[model samples]
Target chain A: MKQIEIGHGSGGRLTRDLIKNIFLKYINSEELDPLEDAAILNLRHQRTAFTTDSYVIRPLFFPGGDIGKLSVCGTVNDLVVSGAVPRYVSLGFIIEEGFSLESLEQIAKSIGEAAKDAGIRIVTGDTKVVEKNKCDGMYINTSGIGEVMRAMPLSNISDGDAIIITGTVGDHGTSIALAREEFSIEAGVQSDCAALHDLLTPLFETDGIKWMRDPTRGGLATVLVELSESLGYGVHLYEDRVPVREDVRFISDMLGYDPLYLANEGKAIVITSGESANKVLEILKRHPLGNNAALIGKVSSKCKGVRLKTRIGGERLLDMLEEDMLPRIC
Target chain B: MIKTQDIINHIRSLVPGDRKVRIMNVCGSHEHTIAFSGMRSLMPEHIELIPGPGCPVCVCPESDIIHAITLSRRADVILVTYGDMLRVPSKDGSIRAQGRNYKMITSPSEAIRIATANPEKKIVFFSIGFETTTAPTAAILETGVPDNLYILSSHRLTPTIMEVLVKDAEIGIDGFIAPGHVSAIVGSNAWNVFSEIYGIPTVVAGFAADNLMLGIAEILGQLKNGKIRTGNVYAGVVRPEGNIQAQNIMAKFFEVADVNWRGIGYIPESGLELRDEYSARDARKVFGLKEIKEEKIPGCICGKVILGKAYPTDCKLFKRACTPKSPAGPCMVSMEGSCNIWYKTN
Candidate 1:
């Protein structure tokens, strides 16, 4: 019998397989066909974007944010990147027995503040107490709904479309890895965990925008690969044009990780027409969350998959992550 | 301070358009830089960069991995090893696939911590790597580990394997890019025999794209001048004498001995084993484990690939029956393994 492995939850190929072979087999629906972060629904009087996410990150508290804040922002950003104005969310918590009440209150306070900043309300909630050892400290799940502002379709992507990123990548994943204290290296990196509605909402007014995605678990590389595969177009990325913090780069190097595949909580990859690329970048640069926005690459019709042009004038192919990146022995 | 592009241009100018120069890199990081940075596309058509046996996990003896899997199966034993080693396939399957009680650690010190935490369990630390990792494992042993912790060492010597490659007539490697991390501990002078006796140009290189290109340029420069010698382009970290304290620590804890590689048979003094004095802390001795008969995975060309005789694509099972997700061989398992790196960038 085939058993589930850790890679299945890594948001890579195995995760896609599990979703396809198991989840989609029983719950087939056209709404889930696109597999976008959030599903678009036609309500009685308005169109809506709905998304749900769970936060089970270890060390509940990290450098820049906590799991409470992450859950709210993660769900809110799912709607924001889907071209929607986030409205309300429902929060649920599963707490382990003997978990400290003070920690719970602190996390609750963080959730309140994050929701407030994102301009979303926690309209409903639920709680469950699991026996000790049945769960980690706590797990939070959030489902968010928003009003669709503009429809950004993958079908709109065309040849010569420019790909832009909101800011530096890998900050959130790198910070989480460091916070685990698995490695003895120290750096001043922080999690880029913030809602992107405030930063990305301006792009809704712009024209010629093709698609948008928050590069979270599988990272910018996976998102691009997925986009290319779905649209039958190719992506060419300039390695030097992709912005990464020096500290994040140092940690990833020491730990044998590729920053391109590392998670970014506050970054959104925007694909737009080449003509409007500079204008989109200008709008992104005006916001604090997108101050490091850059035009990293463009969509192409010549190649079959993602290709990266290195800083030293070499080119290579990039594939979807297969498994969790492990540290080398030497 | 030189620009990477300038180094690339210099390499282009240095290479002869007609002659085929084969340069081999004996470090996984160097290959990682080359593949990840797409350095092969930048090189002249005549110059070929071959990835040698740089990945320690790919060459870790199948017998040792089987022993680790056996030990990890015991309810009272906890097998701790480097994260990459957990995925290496053997006759009985990988430690990750066959065992329930195992932990992946990034450093040797984490083994001691795990031992302290699980006082009642037998913590077998499966230490494997080159001199760079061996020195740290030796350092951890010197500082003292808990009574419950035992070591299962499969550490290989880098220079000895390079010597084997030099003597082999079939693999005609014209130049060498020595591993910088190994040189940092064993000293850059360790590779002098290849340059002095074998008359092959060797340059110690770091993992950066520019440093590697500079190393390649130096190798071509040596070939052009007919004055080949062991050169150091990663001079900022690697020194001629290397880290003396690390050498001393390794000498204190380990002694060189004949050991079997995964695909290659036994090579004399190519591996390090714990001294007899530390037999009590040796997991093999304490557990009375013997090296099992080695078996090769059918249709896997890892043996040829590790020796630089074949490319990963040359293998029939590369992307078909074998892949990073379900690696049928050791080479496809570890990130440092050439097949894995090649598969990623291909």
Candidate 2:
């Protein structure tokens, strides 16, 4: 009945009508006043790392988890990668005016459950309405602030360090890509978007651990390039060591996408010394998140840039990600 | 396994310089491999791998997309394609960008079924992908489609694209890192054309960083020693002739036809079309678009990029206005489009 779909985004009557009729009834948060651009939160932290990201993933619901779970886990992973124990997160929802209230409720409940699992509070939030045609079914923007844990020297990444990946690559991005029904392949795939801090907590305390990073947006390639740019060191990654699912590898061959450049929400790369590398990996393997963790390669002071060792005893230079393989795939 | 560091040292010895030698890979899988290995930081200063138009999703032309849009809006049609084609742009708009009605699916088999289900609606599967995808499209056609079901076959053969690049004097490509899946389907015979015509060394590569690096090493070796031939670095999957069954299926349902590449004009006998037995399901024939002209997007250098004559960064709209979200050309849409690959990876 509502022809004015985007009108709900204007902070006018439709916004208020939708919130009062739908959100307020489902969520009993006293701090989430639907009108404000920013919400005031009283927290007990002096230092905070604040990050915001928009989730516009298609097919909101997937095999393992939906966009709701991903929204919370993605933010938690971000904070954890930055060496911050996540404290609290704020979610903003922009819903198409005519979308089902049931879907919204289900998403909200998921957000609540995910927050609980990560031990973070959704202290405050906002909701806006957009016309059905103007927006996808729903768009979520989540911002979180976390307190810096014991100062882990992520900026101290140097040459001759070891590179460790905590599990396989390409699951999250490939899963989303496949779920979009964009390619023709039959594979058992699921999103790897779980909170990674629990696994990372031990690594932060390890000796010679100079830097830590999560392979997200541009996947492991972006992380590798970013490290090289910052530390001014060449990296050597073992091709056979990088663990990837058989199905993902098969599909990657079919579609011509490299599993490495594919995104992983629940994976990270740690740069540390050769001595501590095995120890850190052993400790990591003990954790649930780091079960598939392996020493994929080493930090090389000899090579001045990134390069890959071929399975057939050949060598080619590896480069930074020049573009997105699966755009908006995350 | 040749350890990653040993290869790095060898490459350092090969391309010794004050600053790293930047080697741009023109394939999407290479981009992914480079990224996953974090190989950029792991290599010597004399080697830098840049991304080229390897991701097909990044470089698909807009004219084809416009054609898809036109077909998607038909009341008698339900368009189907791989996921990447949905958001790609055309002269008018994208099939999904325009909010046009069309179904996006992973399989050509699914498109065949949908077409059969909607017997009244003239279903057109927006066919795309390399040899891996062509097999499915061919399989569906060889099996058969309803009279109303048609396919606007925009599928291109990989070797033709490679031939176009290798022969291009302006491309400046010293060697080629041949596609793995395409090589698996079409075999190394297709690449033999490159060695025969242009004498450029071609390496059949795997998706792993090590495999790709080996392919690159072979290419660099060829470049250093002045050799020209096809090397199957990816012996794990690729063979000299490729998958015979897939080739048979393709040959059974379709024939080589001179189809238009969005930016690169028409390469003679480079595209696939349904044979006479399956021509009734050809969307172009059913829709009376036998005369569909390849309309070039104004001021777009996608054609030049596809030919490897121009780098994506050379285009004025490479980053500024023409992005994946608001693509001005087809090269900015398809995953394998050069511009899209550069924009996403670089």
Compare the candidates by lDDT and give the number of the best one: 1
Per residue, candidate 1 scores C-alpha lDDT tens digits across B283-340 of 9899999988888789998988888888899999987898988899988888889999
Query: In model 2, what is the error at residue A272, expressed in angstroms?
Result: 12
List model 2 lDDT by residue over A263-300, tens digit each.
Answer: 88889887778788889989999998889999988777
Interface RMSD (Å), each candidate? 1.1, 8.1
DockQ of each: 0.59, 0.10
Q: After superposition, how far is residue A206 of candidate 2 from its true place, in Å?
A: 11
Candidate 2 lDDT over residue span B1-346, tens digit each: 5876666666555553444333445566666566544556556555545554455553344556677788777676688888878877665667887735699787877887787678777777878766677898888767766776678777777776666666555555566778787788988777887666776777888887777777777766665667778888888898998999999998888889887666666678877887877667777676776445566666778767666567678898887778866788777765566566566534
Going through the candidates in order, the fraction of native interface contacts each one reproduces equals: 0.86, 0.05
Q: Largest DockQ belongs to which candidate? A: 1
Evaluate all candidate structures by whole-model CA lDDT and list the values in order: 0.87, 0.73
* Model 2 / residue A46 / CA error / Å: 10
